[model samples]
Target: MKQIVIIMIIASMLLFTSAAATILPPPDLETQGILLTTDVSALGIFSNNADLSWRHSSEVLDANLNLVDIVWDPETGLPVVDPETGELIEIWELQPEPPLKYDSASFEVQMATVYSEDTSAQYGEIAYSKNSMVDTKALPASMSNVENDRIITYTGLNGNRILSKENLMLSGAGTPGVPSALSTTCAQCIPPGCTCYPAFCSFVDTGSKIDMSIVSATTSGEVRNLNKIGGGDGERWPPIPSVDGPAHMSYSIRVAELSSSQPSVGYVSTYLNLENSEAGAWCVGIPSLMQELSINERKSVDGYVSLFSNLVNYESAICR
Candidate 1:
């Protein structure tokens, strides 16, 4: 009898263990109380009062990606929130993740500094260090008269914390678009004398509820009458559609002077001409960018529940 009991107990334990293992699904967004959807319109707005209940759900299961906190200085570790004013104050820096480097041929990334304007803690200002990453195709298709202008594209904050600003612009000045890793090698990459651009974006506040907007800019500008470029339109350029979704909108920046000849800011006056080809025609601006980066306030899977929990908890403390 005793032997039989022992065997039964062992069997029960084995069953429980097996059940637990099977129940442990893969890392996913749905397990975190979210519905993974590429539809940007479904994500809702970036405002604090915006309602996400309609888009909220607890069903996703496959994890798409993961984000890790880079870490901060002990001095910068402890966060400061003005008790009276209810503001957050701390030092933040941008660092790029692997598969992407500041001087990669694909894209260049650099960290930027963000400073609070007043003690109010409601907003802040940011400025780049003139450093940039120029890729192999350093110059965008729209670039004219400049051969060294490279255009590299990448994701993530690149170690630089996003300041409490309303807008951000990442440019390689005059070079071909290269991979994110080799962005810093070309002679005319950025910083004038340096081979690449330094860090520029940072901050992990997906809670500040800043709003989200994603923009894909190309270098197809009309250089009409001067030399008829062989392309879709004599002056107008062909649109490069985004594969991500309709939520992903693209724009074109012309480095042309208001006039045909003179250049401003060492480059021609830059202009962002937006296209209306997106599925939902979603808008891309500073506020929109914030929302997208915030993971659309969605939850994570059971495996990644801890990460999402930590991020949410962290945001509460950081954005206070």
Candidate 2:
């Protein structure tokens, strides 16, 4: 009877241990991804000769962060008990997680404008302020060689200057019949029927400004999942990983002629290109306005009235 009772107790204890093991589930392992979008808009104004006009522009951006790999804690999810130490000995450790991947990331900018007068009647020009890029991971550092090796120079009608990759300049000559300053060296050399105007419309040199923001994933999807998995021995589990911070890109334009025109619109766009991939994002900022002005004939008589509409389009691409 004593031996039978002892055997029964041992069997009950074994059954209980087996049930506890079954209740403890394996560590959860599911991959996840992140998506983000941002948008902004503003109003601008251009005025001259007591005439005022307003314009509007807007921008939008989108980004996607995907998981590519994960690394598991060495002792968190292991099987086997050590008889000597009375502790669970780790038999196999999970492999290290792969690097985080960025996919389907893109940014776009669109703009529209309205004016009280026809701006196209007069000669006008549009140009980008500058170009800029920012990344938290210093990824641009790897492409410095490619960027530094290339330089673009632009020669305008009156003079030449380095043009920003983000900006486009489209300008027209002065009034067709009006003599330009470049036509002759003498200020009085104007023909009997010709009146001299500046070589180009002084209003053609307006500049633009832009501002932008963005966010991206820096860790693998598997690592992000570890934070949700609760049960792990304090000694074997690793600290939870944190998410990456947002990145920023911005630029501005400044010209002497358009110095007084207040810029109400700031737009920024960006994209993350995968390794050996050709994917990229397209961005554009366009400002439109109309101006009504009276041209003086012979510098005295009221000349024919004309309306001008100016549409300036700035475009660029982002690839990472």
Candidate 3:
């Protein structure tokens, strides 16, 4: 009976251990909670936002392809007008559909600071510095302190504890799940000096509840930069869509121009990165568990998510 009782006790202990193993400890929860609180809430906005911008670019390209040389009146040097309508047919009007996105889709990706200056980057020396595009300059005076409009975390009184204002342009900049490993040989690294040019729609979705009725994110806290690299103060694109401070990211998405125009939305279900060889590379997209959402958008590159804009137009609120 004693031996039977001891065996029963051992079996119960084993069961208890297995159950406890499945539980997450508080410290780790606290650590990971920041990511859930912050990036998780905005996943839809990022993925869908990129999808919308992609559609916008496609529309612009279509317009450019169809455009013909304007017949300008030699006397007035102005674009000739329609004789029947008596109104000038603007370049945009000539397009089959109204241009829904910005004209340019180029952005500055700072990875190689030691090399070229233009949007073109040098091999092995990718530009590594980013800048601010959605500072208060993009916000109306009345919207001050409306924290949801941009990505920023406060410290002391107004000091943003996370990334500085200049780094605002780098949302989804680097691969989220890529590990931070260096290459000793050129063959082991990505083809260096790769430049990404992205375009945006005119209407930048502020991601505030007022803009598109988005869920509020905990925009302030420490984010893990597990895969940090690049030049000047080092660049960071973590293993997930996360940052180490509070921020409100603004995105370029086309809203309803007419009843016929549909709202653009995409569900980001996976992350894909191909560096080095297939041994350590990851090129898979993870589907989200949420109810079905349309895959309306992807990045300029096949699965890249960061929207690269060349020009940062404060007036247009275009963050490249």
Taking the tens digit of each residue's C-alpha lDDT, what string does model 3 give over 1-320? 11110000000001111000010000111111111112222111121121111111111233333333667888989988899977565443434423322222211111100001111111111112222111111122123111112231111112111111111221212111221122111222222311111111111111111111111111111111111111212222111111111112223211121122222111111111111100112222211111111111122211111221211111111010
Encode model 1's per-residue lDDT on 127-163: one tens digit a residue: 1111121121112223321111112111113222121
Worst 10 contiguous positions by lDDT, candidate 2 = 215-224
Which scores higher on lDDT, 2 or 3? 3
Give lDDT per model, in order. Answer: 0.17, 0.18, 0.18
Evaluated against the true structure, the overall lDDT of model 2 is: 0.18
Per-residue CA lDDT of model 2 for 263-300, tens digit only, reads 11112121111111111111111111112222111101
- What global local distance difference test value does model 1 have? 0.17
TM-score of each: 0.14, 0.16, 0.17
Give the range of the ten consecutive residues with the poorest summed lDDT in model 3. 5-14
Using TM-score as the yardstick, the better of models 1 and 2 is: 2
- True-structure RMSD, every candidate: 31.9, 35.6, 25.2
